[model samples]
Target chain A: MANDKVTLAHGAGGKVSQELMEQVILPAYGNPVLNTLHDGALVEMKGEVAFTTDSYVVQPLFFAGGNIGKLAVCGTVNDLSMTGAIPRYLSVGMIIEEGFPIKDLQTIVSTMKKMADEAGVVIATGDTKVVEKGKADGIFINTAGIGDKIPGTHISPENVKPGMKVILSGYIGDHAAAIMAGRHNINLPASVQTDCAPLNKMTKAMLEAVPDIAVMRDPTRGGVAAVLNEIAEASKCGILIDEDEIPIHAEVQGVCDMLGFDPLYLANEGKCVAFVPAESADKVLKAMRTSPYGQEARVIGEVTAEAPGTVGLRTGIGGIRVVDMPLGNIVPRIC
Target chain B: MANDKVTLAHGAGGKVSQELMEQVILPAYGNPVLNTLHDGALVEMKGEVAFTTDSYVVQPLFFAGGNIGKLAVCGTVNDLSMTGAIPRYLSVGMIIEEGFPIKDLQTIVSTMKKMADEAGVVIATGDTKVVEKGKADGIFINTAGIGDKIPGTHISPENVKPGMKVILSGYIGDHAAAIMAGRHNINLPASVQTDCAPLNKMTKAMLEAVPDIAVMRDPTRGGVAAVLNEIAEASKCGILIDEDEIPIHAEVQGVCDMLGFDPLYLANEGKCVAFVPAESADKVLKAMRTSPYGQEARVIGEVTAEAPGTVGLRTGIGGIRVVDMPLGNIVPRIC
Candidate 1:
């Protein structure tokens, strides 16, 4: 506890490890189930549950809106929500580099607790391992979550069909731009912050309003382009989008243009693209707009019967161009 | 796919990411639930369930008997089993250092699948991320598991009371000895390999044969000494063990003695310590001995009313010595 930086002993599963758990971790995320300190947490669960896991290795650790801790929690929460489940429990596995600041760890953990509280999930169980200095970056977090599946809802790429409306919850490339700016020391407008927020509430509301929604995916790493291409291939349907309708913050657009980065392939941490039946598009969009995270939700595209298994973009000049799945790393560790 | 080494593109959430999933991961872990390829996997659950997570950063990814991948899966499964649960599902999250061999990745993943199959659990969901070279160790694996709690069993340290017998599943410290030997380039007998096998079946048998088992804990990170100390504190009872009765392989004992290590403080990947009523201890031990993983099961100690919240070791020299909780790193990354 006296040391400001983590040491190998802190992860040696000895007295120091217990001190870290009791002092640093338990205070932030302890609940009755987790406080038991059993090898695993015991909780009552029934029916169907959705399970998901994600590892956060985002660089800079902190960016405009959130840190790796917040992303770790929200990313798993959104993944469960996208599966039509109410996010419930999460397990955190942290790999910390020796000599890393304990203060930074505390900040990250507190941020994680805040996000977990907002997403209505408990940090049920966790483990931490510290690697020798230089063997790892600052810190990498892996979060696995369990959520109760919403009844009467079937959300999957298999449900995606021709004629379904494609909804973009908000602007793209903000997360990537924020991270790039931080890494390159490029000054940006105050408005060009990372769009990192939990989308569980918004997605839950949309699902409640329309349980028959085909599919919902948070375009995090490969951006919307990858999501669209996967859906198209899985559903055996073509996806066509209007370039004018795909929302991009003006500053974010400028950053992308300046860097020769295609916004379509850039990551967005807090956005989701939902495929809804034509009849339910308006209702689902309205439901999404009711939440702050989705206030800018728009119908950016539609599933098409032609050109099955491909995505196309209708440009401003009234010409259509193929939108390819991102081929390689545009930006590594963007989240 | 053409690259022999994993690149940043594999974790870019783009086409290469998909290829990694379909070509490498899916082929190894494909199941009905995981094949859905949604944001999460939907699994059926009923009643009380146990959830746990552990991150494996073991050095020398491959050690005697198993590699980190096998350790990743078996560790979680054993944790769930130690909670008197029937392990069912696991979520794997991997962080690979850039330039890590794809062949090694494939070998590790296939070993994971093999171990999961042996444990009768499914790899339900997973995530992968790649960091720049030198930013991470060769690879780190995080596994989170879910299991159904065995009905009518109250496995908790609080249930551990005075007069309860302490049962150790098998010989201690083989795992640590093997790892230490590998790291220090010390030769070891072939029989002194890591005892990193899934203990679900063995524990399940014990629990079924004796439903009133008080507590169960796998002596993983901090080894049996830490486990006993924690149990003593949590149960508010003193634990007294006979050092002569504690089982340790001859070669492992020699290695520990030569290296100034105590087998009591050495880690075990596939061992558990259980607390049970005196009347049930024999039956539980009998059940444990029926499994290959627990062939050396022994009643090495007992709970005592005197010196509550402490552990005492009765040495062969006719003197009782206090067994302190491990205070520092004995072996780093020994998982």
Candidate 2:
């Protein structure tokens, strides 16, 4: 406990590692399965399941609203949520740099425990490895989640069709903007904090209300433009979005304007884009609006039969522009 | 294909990332679940499931007999196998350094595919991220595996009692020795190769033959000594092993002697130790010996009622040495 920093011994799978697990990790994320301390956890599972993996390497480990640990948990949970699965268990893998602050690691793990609890999942099993000081950044976390797939629910881009309406669950670009602001020390408005929260509950409600929702995608990484473009390519259709209808906070918008960045391509940790049949759009949107994370839900676009693999943005000034899939890297480690 | 080296753009979740997936990754690890290209994969899983995770940050990415990619797959698969589960699916998460060679990435992915196929598991889902050159080592892989837990399997340390016999799957120290030799350019014999192979099939056979195996653990990091000490502590029983009976390859022993390392404390990627009721020991050992991976399997020790929570080694000489859990970092990234 006196060791303020993580040493190579902490990850050597020896007494030091055992102490870390028993004193730090176990106490933070203790559960019956994990407490067993076997290399893996055996749990009774049934029905179809969704499986996903994601690694969080966001710079400035601590962002405005969440750290990499919280992002790691939410990202994987949201990935499973998108597949219409009731998120269940998560396995965490940490690659820590030698001499990294053990306190920071503990803080990150605490955040993971908090987020996992909020998402209604258990940290079933985990592995930790420490590399030499420069061999890795402070710490990178990989979380893989498993969830029981809901029967009668099929979520895929292939199910998207012409005349389907695209709904944005909430604001976009908040996560990327928050991370950027923290890295550059920009004094953005307090309201511009990262919108990093678990979207599974909101998503579950929407799915249950409208099982025919064609495609459900969380606009992380490449954001709305990339997601719409992927949908168009997969469904072999065109997507047209009214730029004005896309919800963007004034503060986040200001930050994007100042940085010459397109909010459409910015990453978001908590938002989702659902392509639902036109008839069910209102019902799904109403259900989304009922959730705290989806209070700003709105219909932003619709799928088209023309231009089979292109996304078009209809500007407020009556101009239409083709939005290609994001090219090159605008920002790295935004997630 | 023009870009022979990976760039930060490749992990930006944009057009370049898509090309990397479609042109390189997809072709190598394509499967029905993964081909859907959803954020996560949906699979039909039923019954008891075992889940585990491990991150491979082995230095000298490529060494004798295996590479980091192969280690990543085998490590997670073996972890699941140790729980008497038939490894079914694996999720891969890669953190790559910018400017890494695309050829090397392809090689690693291909190696993963080959290993997964050999292990009878599908690479169901994956994520890729690129960090700045100095922010990470060339590549670190985290693989999480899911397996169907055998119905009657109850492998645990607490199941160990006074009359259980410990069986080691094969020779130890080859994996750690291979990595060490590669790092220090030691002129070791060619046979000093990593014992990094998936042991799921062999384990499955053994479990089917002896349903009452007391415990199963892969002697990975910290090796046999660490594993034995842990078992002693967990079961609150004494473990007495015969040093002369322990399996050690001549070349591995020579290297360990030259390096002032204990083979008992060296890592092995593909080996496991199982505690079987004395009556079932022959049946389990026969089943293990029939598999290619377990040809060298041998009964090395037994549980004891005295000296609870301690591991005692009966040497070739008349003295008995108490083996404490490994305390310091021997080799940093032996895994």
Q: Per-residue lDDT of A20-103 in model 1, one digit per residue for the tens?
A: 998899988878878998899998887899999999999999888889999999999999999999999999999999999999
Candidate 2 off by > 4 Å: none
Q: Model 2, A1-335: lDDT tens per residue?
A: 76988999989999999999988899999999899989999987887888999999999899888899989999999999999988999999999999998889889999999999999999999999999888898999999999998877888889988999989988889999999999989998878888988989998999899988888999888888899989998899999999999988888888889888999999999999999999998899889988899999999989999888999999999999999889967779987
lDDT of 2 by residue, B70-100 (tens): 9999999999999989999999999999999
Least accurate 10 contiguous residues by lDDT in model 1 chain A: A29-38
I-RMSD for candidate 1: 0.7
Quality class of the docking in candidate 1, CAPRI style:
high
Index of the highest-lDDT prediction: 1
lDDT of 2 at A170: 80
RMSD of each: 0.8, 0.9
Backbone clash pairs for candidate 2 read none
